[model samples]
Target: MAAHFPINHHLRPLYRLLSALAGLYMLVFGVVGFVQTSGAEFFTRDEAEWVLGLRTNPAFSLLSLVAGVVVLGANLIGRNVAHHINQLAGVVLTVVGMFSLAVMQTEANVLAFSMVNVIVTFILAAVTGIASLYDRVGSLTAARAEEAHRHSARVA
Candidate 1:
């Protein structure tokens, strides 16, 4: 599976940019959500409260804020660290989204997550995961070798 993944991909910069944008969006959404729901209980399941078309509560807003900070911080650090962070974050987000979806209609929906929130979470997870796949850095020779190997594998 690792052999099939790209190394030093030409579009790495674009992927990084998209991931950074996603982080920014998350940060902004979290701040707005936090402010909007400040008066509500931390885990309130109120569907009336919304931020950027997504239901939110204090707990979810705080979690989002932390996630955004971690993602943006990793991007700033760059190198393999960012790659690892993106990969982990993607999986975590997917799991959280799934869990939220499961409890969405029940009293267990502490995050106040709606279907739209889950959708956005999944989208962000995909963006980060794709970025991770191509975010590796290596010497020119290594990259060339990897590309050649990939090309030959495709031809075979």
Candidate 2:
């Protein structure tokens, strides 16, 4: 009898959920951007002011929408693309979110607000990235093990 942690530790599901949440949040954000780009203001003026500030650059808005959709795709479709690729994509999403914040900081009026968003985005990205990477590693390892087992069986 050895004291050993379970193979599927507490972190695995945590990561999956985190990645899922990251994707879900991005999906919502993207939808909002898309809506705004189409001249739809779904938010109260106060709330919109609190977040988006005054300017509505259609190009930046479109970028936000596109990025959100891409991040969501990375989280959901990573596993399908090869485990390593999925993990890398998660990391990419995290970096992109943070990078977008820096880009926002360059704006004339919304420096502080954009920085705040940057912080939030970075946190989500890191959490989801770690989880996604962990999942990818586990999946790849399992796949390799299964492949090895199949090879042995074939040789027998």
Candidate 3:
């Protein structure tokens, strides 16, 4: 009585949806930044580049858009792929946010964003990243439990 191929436990669809939404937000944010500003400079935090008080530049916007696309695309591929994508994005964004905070007043950040903006990014990163990781671990544990149950039943 070996355990069946079907894995009963898995991450909820919400995690996948959240990841997709994050990506869409980045893509739209980039497009909106472009539309809102006339100067297509490679990098600037001028008032014109402000979207809801968060500064954005061509490079920043492009990067966000790319990240979003990657996340969304991963979700389309499969649950495992999506989980990995969220995990990767989480680590990157968390680091980026912390870096931004460290260099908030410095000129090192060409993609300088307001402190509030940076904080928001960190929150998003943490939420999606942690949730996906939790879901993945839970699913794995459930699968293992099911396998153990099946093994014990056959032994009995």
Candidate 4:
């Protein structure tokens, strides 16, 4: 859709790739979480162990699974839906990253790895945010053009 509005094709691929990867990441995480909760034992102790129980939160896990699926499905849809999906994904990642950082600091004894994840997730969030804006702008241009065409056709 943005093709008529001077889009950077280079950016589209990047956005789609990031969205897809993020989706895949969440999908895998959800499946793993489900499995882990259904009686698989992990040898962990204390703070980290305590937080492991938090992963069993039905709300968080379900949200993760649904968000991942919605994001991936949006990519596969038409332009308007894709734009909105990218926007939502960006917001989710940004907030989730910040929350993860806070949780890691407070809930775990050794937060080195968690901190790394937080940093990476934040970067992903930033990239998605920019991409979302670009896509939305492009879609807006396309929509206006379509509207103009419809008006002209009706008048003719």
Best lDDT among the predictions, by candidate number: 1
Q: After superposition, how far is residue 7 of candidate 2 from its true place, in Å?
A: 9.5
Residues 8-87 of candidate 1 have per-residue lDDT tens digits of: 78888887788788888888888998988888888888543888888888888888888998888888777777888889
* Model 3 Cα lDDT, one tens digit per residue, 1-156: 431432433454666777777777776887777666646677775543777456887777777778777877876664567767787889999998998888878887778677876987897697668655543433767778756865764434
Model 1 residue 53 distance off true place after TM-score fit, in angstroms: 1.5
TM-score of each: 0.89, 0.53, 0.76, 0.58
Local distance difference test, candidate 3: 0.70
- Per-candidate Cα lDDT values, in order, are 0.84, 0.50, 0.70, 0.57
Stretches of candidate 4 exceeding 4 Å from the true structure: 1-10, 40-60, 107-113, 137-156
> How many clashes show up in model 4?
0
Please give, for residues 1-48, the per-residue lDDT of candidate 2 as tens digits. Answer: 332212333455566666667666655655555556455343222223
Instruction: State each model's C-alpha RMSD to the native.
Output: 2.2, 9.2, 6.3, 8.4
Judge candidate 4 at residue 79 and give its lDDT. 67
**lDDT value for model 2:** 0.50
Which candidate achieves the best TM-score against the true structure? 1
- After TM-score superposition, the amount by which residue 131's alpha carbon in candidate 3 deviates from its true location, in angstroms, is 3.0
- Candidate 1 stretches with Cα past 4 Å from truth are 1-3, 153-156
Better of 2 and 3 by lDDT: 3
Could you tell me the TM-score of candidate 2? Answer: 0.53
Candidate 3 backbone collisions, by pair: none
How many residue pairs clash per model? 0, 0, 0, 0
RMSD of 1: 2.2
